[model samples]
Target: MARVQHAKDVAAERLLSIPGVHTVGIGYKRRGGEVTADLAVIVFVDTKLPRADVPPDRMVPLEIRFFMDSSDREESVPTDVVEQARPVEYTHIPAGTLAGRARPVAGGRSIARAASGGGTLGGWVWDGLNDEVVLLTNNHVLGGAAGTDVFQPWGSTAATDHIADVVRTGTLDATIAAPVNAADVLEEIEGVGPAVFEITTATVGMPVEKSGAKTDHTTGWVEYVGLTGHYGSTNDFQVAPDPGMPNGRFAYYGDSGSLIVERTNPSGGSWKRVVGLLWGGNPELGNAKAHQVQDVFADLNLDTLCAGAFEEFLDNLFAPNFPEEPLKVTPIQLPEPVTMPLTTGPRVSLSGALLALQQAAGRPFARSRPLHRGMARDVEARLRLSRMGSDLVTAIHENRVGLARLVLDRQTRRALASAAAPFVEGVWTADELLGRQVTEEDLARFHRVARIAEDHRPELQPLLERVNRILGELPGRSFDDVLR
Candidate 1:
């Protein structure tokens, strides 16, 4: 009886048992996780419950109480998390460690209320300077907070953080906080403050913790701190802090502004420092990113509790809040996760890096007579990749970061594999996809990448510096090492 069943099949039978029940309901669905034999029960019900309380689009949380020969069991139903929280702005935000704890207007969302731990959503803050603190969040999510004040978007643009204001205007004390306007919205919104960050002297791999409304408080370790991307850009990381903790379930909605506190054990004693303010993860990955709070406070030197006077002042610079229409900044679908384990081998697995490198190579070994149609499609698959490799060499020699970024995009990465196939073709069987080769022309193209590792290619550097022990073995190898 645990197997899921058609609501219609059991609906009539259930209604027949209830004399006063005049209507029967039916539905079909596979429960979360799996369809186990123990749970394969058909859902049919005869209810006098108020169905009108919720709209057709709304889902009701039903607590099913059922028992077998031994004992009855109960399961709490779930509602779409989005419907519970509406969009909000910094104006409605408050300062605290707990996420989603703020009193969102009748219908809105708060970071204090996001999921907890690594999987939680919402913006957060960190005490930045001598007195003031800074707020953080994404630009796309700003529109939602400004418009509806509801946390409706779960998969996409749902959570946000804004600069907190302490002042009050009318009874509508939007003093808790207000939203910042990055050039995206200037004319329409009222006091608009763009999200900003302050820098700190915190080192990488520090242990940190933050509070959220949903889960209260959680802690994690830093994977990277003050990191610069391809173009010398700074970024923050908060991955699985410790080995014991499970993924997600750490923080929930409305946890934004939670502090990332790390402790340092000095020779004299141990102390804690404020590092950053929560910023939404990158759009493609949705991984959490934060603004260096230390720098933010120092930049503005604004007061935090001055009834939000600083926030009020900053807001005034932005366009008033006359949302002509709903802002276009909405969360889109998330990208697929990278689940493969880290593996290393000799030949640069250009295909893995390119994502579709094999497709690009299109090198096809000759086969016996065609046994089926569409055999023409089996021509040469590896060649396609070889051509791709040649193209990459040319593009790299030309020095085009834009082209490289394009090739790296998840969808079209195959083109890069197609370009990189040749350079890696005759590579040593024991070689792994360490990184792209450096060239002589590349010296003028991107010198930074070239400097990190000594030139293994003879043509690029005639003489290898043997002063450093790390460079000892480099010069002994053939110059062609860079090319292969």
Candidate 2:
């Protein structure tokens, strides 16, 4: 359910900026009396029906359905206007206190210390197997090994004040510290409510709170989940910084291990549920990435150690809103999450860009292998007449513009231009089959390919430009109009 909601959130973030889109939600698409899970983007206007021109179509794998909020409906405002209260942003409490209720240690306050140094104590957790309580923080904060001396207020607190011992290390940059006195720690957190035994998975757009050594208590929104950042794969998620808060970054350098929890309504109680363990993030992007608690617990092998307790908790966490009926068709599976890999090469490839565009436009007609071979052959045959076929192929393969331009003289240009007509026609051959679903992905690919061509064959620029304008028309635009 969280996964589905997260997908909807990604779609909403991309679509909300469009002129007409009012709201987005998780819903079902029915075909032949069977329901398929999908994200529905809703737009309502008393005048002309508006279409949401969502960008980066590949962001969410779910099939998006544009819904017009009929003019006849009684309600004027959007249905999803209900907002969750934001968590308190700052704390005046001093550091050195135990996590939770002990002396109100704000999120940014430093608590636990290790051999390398001290780090902010994020939150607390229960050792279901040993029947003991432990302070939850980042593995990097606790020396990433057992028996590290944990200090309160760090070594800077009037000479080292040892408070606990590092017990275990877990995936997702998490560690458990067995406090000398289990009862000394309180369940209550500064600003936020108590940390409940209940755990919740991250949902996109969900309000959440966290405390760290550098920024104290802060609140933010869940921007994404199942995100693969520079941090190696797995179930990691991201939190967008709260613009209203003073904290500059969601998670700072010393803030690793901060525990993020769901925001509770009405201001106070034990309603807050564990959500994520903050490891690191890019502040420039105004987001912090954390490992989802479900994945963290699973990596810790808690299900095997705690047996029934773990399974019961998971059951409650993942229970459906209503009993789900089987669907006629298999639901669309989201692509495996990946942040662009760090490498020194062309960020976008011609064939790669074309492939992404085809999928986005619902026109996965034929494999790019056939198209690549055909295009390469056409270019080859034309350049061979100029006795520069190998040079052109090497230039294209190496992405070298000067070499390509030198080889593509007027005569070769004329031949390539003529050959390009057949290749371009193939792209639209399945337009009827795909319903001409143009998207930003296609526009971007066209622009990128055109820009590369501009660096080589200037004559081909106008041709690709025309192709882009033609495709852009299907989603609501004209040849001369700006993309909507």
Candidate 3:
């Protein structure tokens, strides 16, 4: 027998003294402590259970503790209600375990061969990660062609391959569908899954529907958008339709990859714009949250709508090279939030970030300092190039090291920080510079910057309105979006 340590023993070591529980047995559920000299705490049980040790209470239960400290892995989620904005906590939360959606139509309608008992309802075309765009339909919906092998849910072993990877030119849509020839034969494999395809989200309320091999056609409202979630048992990724329109209608199972939309159902009105792809949902709340079919498309990279600079920057981050500095603008003028690849001379450890703030408050070397290799090529040169920028360089450089403690002297830092607009310390944030925060004057400066910002094109209107709203929401001239 091994010398089993109880949870109590682990806690004692971390505290450097005894913990809440004075004593514990071999197996008991309780707060954890460090064990095996690692950061993780060891789980324990109250009994060894040579046989099934029955509890006096007649109930055998297991204990699992969710670490509360990790906000990223929160056990609690947003409250399901109307009008409340979804809190930006977990960036990528997926909706549910969904396959896609399919419908049956005339034999001539489907991508499947007409002779294979054909009928086709509209399906969705979604992103499949690379150049591939997955076509979702019922296994029965799409008939076999003479050639090309299909992968079943698990593997091809005679279980009838339902999901077929799209190998045609470009993506097949309502206007165009993947064609099937006589040589195609869908092989079946044992122990697989429902035939599936991911549906990429279209516009804000693009209408869509599905006809599964089993259940023909079903409709629902577009809910939730831009979601990121994990598969049930695996870490496979999903980014669901992140936002949705009014009302709470959405997709359900057997409707996996169901084209989410404000579908132009013979019904009328702008409210009918289709959105969302059916992937999964919350069983606990019934139909409260519907996952996006686009998640699958995005996961698979199926949809090929906008793959210009806007698209490439997302997946293949380093695909494009930046020859110049990213644009700088006031928060009001900023287009969308961009994650520019920032390089500091050295790694920004916690202590280092704190140290730089103090140094900024004090004095820094007058000229450039060779901090580390990761510093931008022009960083030191820029410091040498401008006088105030040198000090701003040091302060900004410290902020690069996680410097967040100081009550920002917007005026003082602005004087030193900006290479373009170097002025005196009387002003700080837009609020300060405009003689107050986010005034009409601040909005004017925002427009000046927006006029020059290439990214701000097509974004000026909404951005301007949002800035006003945020300023109106501000309490006593406090600025929090800056912190964000």
Candidate 4:
């Protein structure tokens, strides 16, 4: 992986200088419209051309060979030429009223400098050295030196709309702003819930999602990591929109400073781990570029402030109201079972199990059927269970004894166990049930129970481990040949 990255670094500037090349990075090679396992230096161009029509010097090379000082040998790396238009910074003037202002401003909302156009307010972070929570966004969006005023929802002039003042600026087009009232800022995004305190490095083919000012919430896959672009940042990464999406778009104008996060499914809900900061992209072609979030943190000396396990537990416990009175209701009646004639049929196979597991893990919020009646009640139940499950996992992972003790209280445990009974039992019998394919909702339910058991119930650890092993064997989870 280091060799490939080094080779890309060596070749990026020269490639960018070429007339047709727009960006340079490392990615999987494509052959006859199919992605291959081979690693290649990817060159983005406006259009693919036949060798006959282009000048020899302007054409992209098929392979890049460079001498390695560490190995004392010349290495040859293949190249992949992809057709993609040049990406531009995502900042623009507001044409109409934008709807993204709140008392406590969060990430993924429109914000701009007093004199500049609008851009997204990435998220909130803690400046430990300064002992204050501040807003994280692009330097271009919150331009000028320290003390520049920023407003939310585009061209607002009200004094109340003036939210933050630029505090620090750094490389990767990142900047931090001190909120006028620290209490008026939140550590969450608009559509996505609380941001996870942890941050991770981007890997090729990793599934990612982001909420931006222009596009709202969208999911995508990392096309390349350690990408070198015209922006002069060596840690930039490229993302392409999910093929299943309707418009095939990810970020757009006014979407700068949006936070790109990993799409992960834990017990409580879909938690987002900060991965990168969206700065610019070619929205029409669905090619977006972002800086590695770790770089942003290191450069700015900032840390994320997210909700802890005990806080989440308390919020889940008291936020909702249960029915005040027990109403008389008819019990469900079961029909008499009848033996059926046996016929030749396909038995459950490993492939089927893997498919079910992938669907469950990949799309955490997918539902099998739409609910008409009692929808709100059902949603509340799921959310409560999810929160409790997440709290247990977080406590275990962080080794928070106090939080764990609170989460494992007798009353809380009983409520959680009762709510998770159906899902926990289904995990055991899921393989036994034949004929029908497992639905994402069913697997999501089982996943929640498995997470809770993995953290609290030792007896179920073996089952959970076996399930994880199967998940590890699933294909298409990663696509970086360099990592192999």
C-alpha lDDT score of every prediction, in listed order: 0.30, 0.49, 0.28, 0.66
Runs in model 1 deviating more than 4 A are 1-140, 143-199, 213-215, 229-232, 246-257, 263-272, 280-288, 298-484
- Clash pairs, candidate 4, are 268-386
lDDT of 1 at 34: 33
lDDT, residue 281, candidate 1: 31
Per residue, candidate 3 scores C-alpha lDDT tens digits across 1-484 of 0112222232323322221211112221123321122212222222323225544342222322233433455232111111122211111112222212212111101233223332222332322222212344333323223223333222122324332433332122221123122112111100111122112344322334433222234344332232222231111112222234112223223333233343352332212222333333442222322334343343334442222111221212211122223458765656778678876796454434654642343212111111222123223443444454354444433222111111012232232233213221333223333233444544444444333331323323443344445445544343422222
Tens-digit per-residue lDDT, 1-484, candidate 2:
4434444444555544544343343333334445344323222221232124334431222344333344443321112211112111122133423332234233334665533555677655555433234567776667567766677665443332555677677655777766554334544445565453446788767889887766667789886554432234335666878887774666555566777888874333224677887777655544576878777776654321122222222222222222334447977677987577676876565655765654453322212322112233333444444333344333333322222332223343334334333223324222221233445654455455455556655644544455455455545432223221
Count of clashes, each model = 118, 6, 83, 1
**Candidate 2 steric clashes:** 6
For model 3, what is the alpha-carbon lDDT of residue 273? 25
Clashes of 4: 1
Q: Show where candidate 2 strays beyond 4 Å.
A: 1-109, 156-160, 229-231, 265-269, 301-484
Q: Report RMSD (Å) for each prediction in the order shown.
A: 24.1, 28.9, 22.8, 22.9
- Which pairs clash in the backbone of model 2? 107-211, 107-212, 107-216, 108-212, 108-213, 108-216
Scored by lDDT, model 2 comes in at 0.49
Question: Judged by lDDT relative to the true structure, which candidate is superior, 2 or 3?
Answer: 2
lDDT of 4 by residue, 308-374 (tens): 2333333333322222234589977669765789889776644346536533433211112211223
